[model samples]
Target: MTTLTKNKVNDLIMSQIPSFGSFQTLREEGLAFLKEKGLPAMKEEEYKFTAISKKLEQSISDFSPAGKVVLNAETVKSHLFEGFDGDIIVFNNGHFDSELSSFQDQSYELNQLSESSPENLGKIAKIEKDPFVALNTAAFEDGIYIKVGRNKQVEKPIYLLFFNQANQGQIITPRILIEAEDNAEVTFLESSISLDEEAYFCNMVTEVKVAQNAHVHYNRLQHENKKAVTVNNFETDIHRDATFTSVVVSLEGDMLRNNLTLNLLDSGCEGNMYGLYLLDGKTHVDNHTNVDHTKPHAESNELYKGILADSSRAVFNGKIFVRQDAQKTNAFQQNNNILLSENATINTKPQLEIWADDVKCSHGCTTGQLDEEALFYLQARGIGKIQAKGLLLYAFAGEVLEHIANESFRKHIDALVQTRLGSSF
Candidate 1:
């Protein structure tokens, strides 16, 4: 791990200036924007519910991260899919580790960021908009660059693994870009693994470009130790006759936030979003998302659910926007939460803003505890309380897991869900 104080993060960026390559101008722009805006404040509407800035300052007086943690291939292998066949890309502390990774397929081509330039690099996820995005743009030393060939379909799903381990603390920024040419089909999964007992922070950004007649599916799994803090920003552009789907599952973390943006740019395009978070202890997870439909005959759907126990907290704020020309658009969004204990809390808001009269849009949110009547019915049948509760919670979470298209991956994720709930219930 690379140790650097938060105060000297800029120095790290400057030191790597020579290796930035085609992203040099973007780094410069990001540096300028960060200088002007600085980090987000609690008073900001977006960060009002999360006091991450304060948490950072309090955790480290100088806001600097130091320390080191190590892991070899054996440890990483243990975390991989058991008896599963797929391509794996490993990232250690936010940088690519080619020696520990393998990609054996002709359906796609890979290039280093310094040697390649994606045409729509900074357009879909503009650094000018978010401070964290700007920081990642300026500080990221290396990341993944993949281009799927036209009309080609990947036989196996690709997995991206991010590992973080620090004794004291460390800040990691990483970037990813995926370009699916016309008529291509692909599925990608992302996982964040935390090893060690120290504090660490990760700010990651991913951008996806789906050309006409192309299909892309991306799923994320975050189950890290309580000392890890995470901020993930995801953006995608859907063109005409294209499709995109993003599913995120959050099981554990100290403080985690997700900012997702989807843009349906042309007619006959579709997008789907699904998320589930189960937490206990003092853990907190927040999600903010936006979907914009700019053309007629476009559709979008979103669903987010959470189960909180103890003093854990969860937040959801989602918006669906339909432009004036986006007539005949079909949009739906919903957020639901279950608080197992009286101390648990949730704040949820789902909204729809439409400038078109002929569009069909709906949004709503709900927060409550497990159904007492259902629980009693199971107990009346001679089932134990813990078993009944597990059955009920698992049923509620199953809705989101059903959206996973890959059967093997879906079953793997289901096992994880069951194990997590089994221990808590």
Candidate 2:
């Protein structure tokens, strides 16, 4: 193990301190926290699979920071929105790009969090226990803050486009905050892309708050370059009778890690999460999710599927916690993976901690290769081996893709999947 010098670590932490000027207490507290805890080591259970401490030690002194990035209207038209028409928020190198975004609707307010009053920072500071959240709170330069008024239903989806165009070895931190008022309904689509071959580090945090009876649909697509590394944290708060649905699709990147946490603060809430990953080469993808049922009569369901080929590795760790008072809670979780090569690997763990006797909770996980009988049957029908394998893989992924309510978006993702599979299909 490489040793990280104290000065190097302090330098990285110091670079992140300027963004938290408004919250003086949090700023000081976070700095002290980092000084105490420092970078997460391999001993940390949450980071066991993807050992980042070594990477930090090797590159700490040579770390690069994102520089200015420019985008034009035509570029935005072609890359940001493309086919969808809605309120769009674009960020380049983690800074708001107002010139490339569109927000003409009246029912919604899209603004930069940095331009808002210092009071609003406290809203995100409330969840500072998470280390990544604290890091984002300290380092975030600019982000989109979208709020839908009460009793209003957005007719179009709110799109967020994040682009990374920094020099090689640049590191960027992007933050997002979304709030849906009571009885309001909205959809959010976030896409992350890269323009060049840079070894970048993206530490992003998204905080979502859903008011009573509100509905929110959130989807995230990650297609960054294989030379980049990303660590994303999603924290959500659901009120009484609210509904939250989240879909995550990851297709490219050298190493990617996502942490999703849902807090059921009130009763009668519904939460659903789905994820699909197609990994090849030496890629590493890890998804860690936690669903907390703090109140009664809440429902939570999760399904994650992975297709691993080559020597890639995937990890899924899901935990469902039912508090003692959370009686009558209904929770289900399933993780399935298909290994296409002998060396391809998957580590799946589903845990349920139920303190309430009246709750109904179950969890299961499965990892295996393709069935020989099914392959033989397809081959016997005159289908080529590669085409048959692609078909089988598509069918496995279709289970989650079928849940996409948007027809065009579903078709777009389907096309992306086919393209990734090469000429096999």
Best by lDDT: 1
Of candidate 2, the 10-residue stretch with the lowest lDDT total is 1-10
- Residue 351 in candidate 2 has what lDDT? 95
Candidate 2 residue spans exceeding 4 A from truth: 1-6, 19-21, 58-65, 80-82, 118-128, 423-425
Clashing pairs in 1: 5-64, 6-64
- Report lDDT per candidate: 0.84, 0.79
RMSD of 1: 3.1
Q: What is the per-residue lDDT of model 1 for residues 1-425, given as tens digits with 9 covering 90 to 100?
A: 11223444455545544344787888888877766676676787888888777665555333233322465789779888755578888888887788888899889988766668877777888997677788778777767789998999998989898888754445677788999999999999888998765678888889999999899999889988897888898999999999999999999999998999999999999999999999899999999999999999999999999999999999898989999999999999999899989999888878889999998889988898889999999999999999999999999999999988667778888999999888974
Q: Model 2, range 1-425, lDDT digits (tens) per residue?
A: 12343455456667645644345565566566555556566667877777665664543343345765877777667674336778878888888888877878888777777566434453643434555565565556567677888999998887788888766555677877788899999888878888787677787888888889999998888888976688888888999999999889889888888998888989999889999999988888999999999999999999999999889889999999999999999999999999988988898989999999998888999899887799899999999888888888888898888766555566777888887765512
Clashes of each: 2, 0
Among these predictions, the greatest TM-score belongs to 1
TM-score for candidate 2, residues paired by index: 0.94
TM-score of each: 0.94, 0.94
Candidate 2: the clashing residue pairs are none
| Candidate 1 weakest lDDT stretch, 10 residues | 60-69
